[model samples]
Target chain A: MAEEIEISISPTGQVTVRTIGIKGPKCVQAAEAVAKIIGQIESRELTSEYYEAEGHVSGQIEVRGRR
Target chain B: MSSVILVTPLIIANWSVISAAVLGACGAMGFTVASGAVSGSGRARSGSSVTRAEIEVENSEVLAGGGGTDEEMVVEKDGVRATFSRDARGALKVCMEGTGYSKGQLKQIGQELMEQVTQQYVYHRVVTELKERGMPIVHEEVEADRTVKIRVRNW
Candidate 1:
């Protein structure tokens, strides 16, 4: 999936950076540059998607017949 | 559903950095850098307050370290003039002065310029950081409201 970052600045000069299609710690890493640039990270909230495991999960089966 | 980060920008930029941002914003907004040496011998006077708005950017190092030389700059577009100077507190301030626009209009312009400066600053900062981290930029654009949006991908 392609990652998307949306930065919105209000007329009053407030900036909000939202990251979509990325998960886990990577999202924070992606947005940190903006936070560092702007000033400080006022508040950060993680959605349920963030807690989900990263990447795809594949199953592997091991079969043993008479060893 | 990925993640959302709300940032309240506290400008801690230096005079040099601010000047760069200001110049970029002025260029983008079609404003020309006017000489700060504009004499006070103008012919007419406007009833409206010349100081439309002011933004203070603090530099803590200047206070702790040795005293630094003051910085001042001026730019204008049409009758709108923006003056950037170092205040008594050693913080940089941008004051909007002019008569062509009303108080509300001047405030709007000042705020917009401030936002542009900030957005450009962040764009440069983030792009540099991404490049340093070896992240490839997928796309970048300045939105209608002058907000800079940059998309970088990790391979």
Candidate 2:
């Protein structure tokens, strides 16, 4: 399965990132790459899956707004 | 199968009234401007009466589109306003109205700010992707929106 990542650039020049794919520190890198494309860095937060997504399932990562 | 993800921009500003930030922010960015006393965008609409602003954005240089018309949207937040639009080639655009600030200068400032914000945004987003999958940040690179994309080469 192909993983997907959605990136958004805010009016304030803020970036919001969300993704669907295999998880872990790897996911962080994915999100970071997008942030850099648009502008600067401010802050970040990891959802619950960031910690639970340990080990893969069916070659895809699940996202649920909340950690 | 090909998958898609929805990313929502998290906005934080001197929002004593909610969308005040949206207007000023959009103005700062070249994509759009603020018109009234308030501004906002992205979120859904409401049946409330308050100051309203409109944002207009388009593929100005036809970088990906063929001289297509710019798209526009209106968002109302805390007596403020906001808007969003996109070009044909997926080149996204945004607008903010209501700031009583510099007319065209806001857009220029926003363009500069977005350059840095986009990088940080990509970094944090990619990190979130990895953690969700229980994987690790094997490698990554984040630049500006048009110049580069977050390429997360996972393991």
Q: Lowest summed-lDDT stretch of 10 residues in model 2 chain B?
A: B11-20
| DockQ per candidate | 0.47, 0.06
- For model 1, the superposed segments whose C-alpha errors exceed 4 Å read A2-12, A59-67, B36-53, B57-69, B100-102
Cα deviation in Å at residue B57, candidate 1? 5.3
Residues B14-99 of candidate 1 have per-residue lDDT tens digits of: 66665677788778888888864332323223675553656554322112222233655688898888876556676656687786
* Interface RMSD list for the candidates: 2.6, 8.2
TM-score of each: 0.72, 0.29
Runs in model 2 with CA error above 4 Å? A54-67, B1-155
User: What is the alpha-carbon lDDT for the whole of candidate 2?
Assistant: 0.41
Task: Give one digit per residue, the lDDT tens place, for model 1 in A1-67.
Answer: 7876666665445677777787888887767765666667777878876787779889999998996
lDDT per model vs. reference: 0.67, 0.41
